[model samples]
Target: MKKLVSLLWAVTLLAALALSACSSNQATEALTGGDENLSLDKEFGGFGGGDESPGFGDPELMNDSPEDAQVSDVIADEPAVIDAMSSDSPVKAFFLRITWGLLEGDSSATEVIDWSGSAEVSRGTLLVLRTIRFEGNDFVHLPRDSRQKVEFTSQTKRHFDGLLLAIIDNDTTASDTDATDGTFTFVAGSFSKVLNFSELDSLDLLEPVGDMGNEVSIVTRAKDIVPFAGGFFAGRWVKTRRDGGEFKGRWINSLGTNTGFLRGIWGINRFGNKVFKGKYISANGEFRGLLAGQWTFTRGDRAGVFEGRWVNRQHKTVGRLKGHFRTGRAGDRRGHFEGRYRVTHRENAEGSDS
Candidate 1:
């Protein structure tokens, strides 16, 4: 009985071994491209053709996929900064011009002004000149067929210059021949700003037109809108009475270069409404500063007036000062300081905005 049992066990063990061998062979066939299991090799072309073995791995596939290829989105930062700098501030429009002279030789007195620049006020440079107000010629004399009779209208006076007038109101259209007899018509109601002229373009007519010379143009430029004193004052302030001689070196603050060589930078300050300030720096660093102290401002009228004292290093009040200030209007230049200031050895008041 024992022998028979042993024989049965031996047969069962051999059968089991055979079955395991078959399973192993099937698995090897699939891995070597024999069995029907889809993989990247079959779908995308590999060296194997069913049950045949290729190399351990496809070198071509491995090389095609780079480890460092980038494929996403990106961002930027300079245009925003540039946009901030180009905007219009209070200081950019702080210049002024006045018209104190009128011409006696032409038709009723009118002034022409013009201004041109970027829609962004800060990008524009100012140019001003004085000229006769443009009125249509004496229309009664010229006939309809005459080219000299082309009608053009007069424009309101621009204080800085007629260029400002022409640009602002398109007044350049008006023209008249010196000796030609005729009348011209113009677009109505263009007159606006005051006018000023330092010299006349032609002497053929009787008088010089525009602001009598007092109506001269003045300009002030800056990157942004700072205070009047801040924009104009610069350098160091030394006492004239001290060993340093008061106005010893250049005094720079905000307004501009405060050297003795500077003429004057005159304009109104919207400082707490509208105020007037002027700087007259001399060789020794002495200057007279004034502010328009009045508050009465009408739409077409002037505003603010200032008066003050300035001393040199010697402790003596050196120069007399005067100027006017106008408010509200875009073309007002009344607060211009014209008088001179003398700088001696003494230091004057500190002109810093602080």
Candidate 2:
């Protein structure tokens, strides 16, 4: 519910903060009002349990060469997407709240791509399925092993990233270490989308890995993903202004801030790292602001007590959000996430560029 997003691109940066992020306009629908369903307790599902992500245990799955990126026999998204926790749990729970229908709407009726997210692992544990000439339901539903066929590929000298190549494209049993443009084919899922980095970048949602052609390992913990509600996330926040004061504001995701300083909409989309970026209407809400932060569990492994921070537009530290939300897997469940913020009133904000 709280997040980012991207496009041809607009990024916010501040010298005092180690974050560069953009806002998304896609999440405006949910921000109109608050949904009471978020009051339920959130569940935290553990990884050392029942769900399985099939990897090569047999000798054939191993790489013949040492340097090649290790591949797995995954029900790849295109081939396999990033490792998905239980679709019903981590994957499904998040998607259930998202407004999926308008994810990639085109102005003209002629459609080129279709995107869908699933709570079931078999369909794809992630969002945004980018493909062309695809007729199957999802990559996971395609041939399990080496039965998937590559339907078409762009003639560019493009190589799939490890996530796209390994998880969504290539199978563990077959490793085309020296995979070429046309020769390499795996019977897992079709990867018809152009492999060009720039083209992939055009897909606003895939910006997380737009900079590189390798696997971008984004390790998201329960703490980070669990607390988010996909809509209005309001909490008591502190500002380091006027000798420090506290205020309550809603954190709008995939869009801009909703209030002034101490509150504003900060757009967050899935990024390359666990870091979350946002823009705030700060400096007393009169000015446009930017904040970059990350989420983590303050206590043990679970999100019993979570923590995060945001650097204000004045290049001052203003947010230290500490709160809790119940973690659950099913989509219908709701969890309450409330916390207090302590402000650090910076008398003289530093850094002209933020």
Candidate 3:
């Protein structure tokens, strides 16, 4: 009886060990088989999984025991099936590769083409191109005639399907069957932003890109010049001093010679361009209308012509006087003053008196 009990216990122990070994092998097979599909999900989303589970009776991947885990038939050094790959859905590295031309073998070769400048698009429509390329390596710059064709063709490409603006080759013409030969270049992996007509006009980006194309061109729209200085004519012969106290006086016709005295304030304009527009007070306390004139200055001497209609206290054109004035006289107070007299008054000078 003691021998029979011991043999039975030994037999039970052997059976338990065999079952445990089978369970362990099954777990190992399950773990390894599921791993390959999981890896595909992380990398390429399982292109060839074909809805089959591991350790199934597919016959090709079936195992004799659970210990025989599923193994990938893929070669370790096989090139990626790019056609089957989702390259169109761009990745960070993909854009980096395209713009920067980083070569892995030959596709990413960095061949620099001449910078053709920039383009603009808006609301999915091509607007204008601001830059023109001169020369490029491994690429032909877009001919002026082919700009429109190239722009239209590029807008349809996979790389620029949704892009608003881009810089591309000029080979796409009506004559060329396959004109998309140039690579789109990018700076820091982004195409330039599109500019509107108003924005472009306001910013003044359109300019003669001087002899050197590398420099930035700035455009400025000009404004109309409104008269800032105009008033009562108080002075005909006015003197301006840099120190202070602007003189305002007028010239009056006298006996024998056209003797006239004047007084008015003289100063430069906002642009520092000389100007003298002020009220002219005659020696007889008669306030003439307004005198407006400009001073064209040179080295040590300055001269200009004064133009204005002289009016008396009754607001009448007593006598018109044309002043061909000059500052810094060589001697006397004579300059050049000539004009027609009023119908009532008569005062005429032969030539000049200094």
- 1-354 per-residue lDDT for model 1 (tens digits): 999999999999999999977854543243233523321122111212111111113333223211211111111113532232232322122222122222111223364433211111111222221222223321111122322112222233422211111111112233433332211111122222222221111001111123422132222222333232212211111111111010011222222223332221122222322222223333333333321122222223422223344333333554333222332222211122222122222234433322
* Model 2: per-residue Cα lDDT over 1-354, one tens digit each: 124534212343342233322211112222211322211111110011111111112122112111222223333333224334222234211111111111111123232222332212212122322221123333323323333232222211111211122112223443457343222212212221223211221111211122222111111112113222121233322211211111223433211122222222111223422232333342222333334444433323212333455444344564444433222122212112233332333333222211
Q: What alpha-carbon RMSD in Å does predicted model 1 have with respect to the real structure?
A: 36.4
CA lDDT scores, all candidates in order: 0.25, 0.25, 0.26
By TM-score, who's the top model here? 2
- For each candidate in turn, the TM-score is 0.20, 0.22, 0.21
Better of 2 and 3 by lDDT: 3
TM-score of 2: 0.22
* Predicted candidate 3 versus true structure: per-residue lDDT over 1-354, tens digit per residue: 999999999999999999987754443233223333321112111222121222222332122111111112221112432211122322100100011111001222233323223332221112121211111121222332332222212211110111112221212232347432233222222223233323321121211112321112222111112111111111223232331113323232211111223333334433444444333332232333333344443223433433444333334443333333333332222222112111122122111221
For model 2 the local lDDT of residue 233 reads 31
Worst 10 residues of 3 by lDDT: 91-100
TM-score-best of 2 and 3: 2
Q: Native-vs-model 1 lDDT?
A: 0.25
Model 2: residues with Cα > 4 Å off, grouped in runs: 1-273, 279-289, 297-304, 327-333, 348-354
